[model samples]
Target: MLIQSIIVGLIIAAAVVYGVVTLSRKRSAFSTKPGCGSDCGCNSGGKKLPS
Candidate 1:
């Protein structure tokens, strides 16, 4: 019973760490400067949709 509890605790800790890492990676992936991609059409720093 004690071993099982320990194992479960470790699993929960690992899941929490994984969740934190995943969230951080996702946030960084989307944390980019606007108007920096190919979607911009003019010199102004604004996003432009293709017509």
Candidate 2:
């Protein structure tokens, strides 16, 4: 019973740590220029007509 409880506690701790790491890294994964990472051509200064 004690071993089971310890295993459960460790699993919960790992989950919490993973959640924090995911949230912390989210900002760095984002880009201010929506088109900079793609070849969508939206980053070009020229205006695009509606298709």
Which runs in model 1 stand beyond 4 Å of their true positions? 33-51
Cα lDDT of all candidates, in order? 0.80, 0.72
Per-candidate Cα RMSD to the true structure, in Å, reads 4.3, 4.9
Taking all chains together, each candidate's TM-score versus the true structure is: 0.64, 0.56
Error of model 1, residue 19, in angstroms: 0.3
**Candidate 2 TM-score, true structure as reference:** 0.56
| Model 1 TM-score relative to the real fold | 0.64
Off by over 4 Å in 2: 31-51
**Top candidate, metric TM-score:** 1
Candidate 1 residue 33 Cα shift, in angstroms, is 5.0
Q: What global local distance difference test value does model 2 have?
A: 0.72
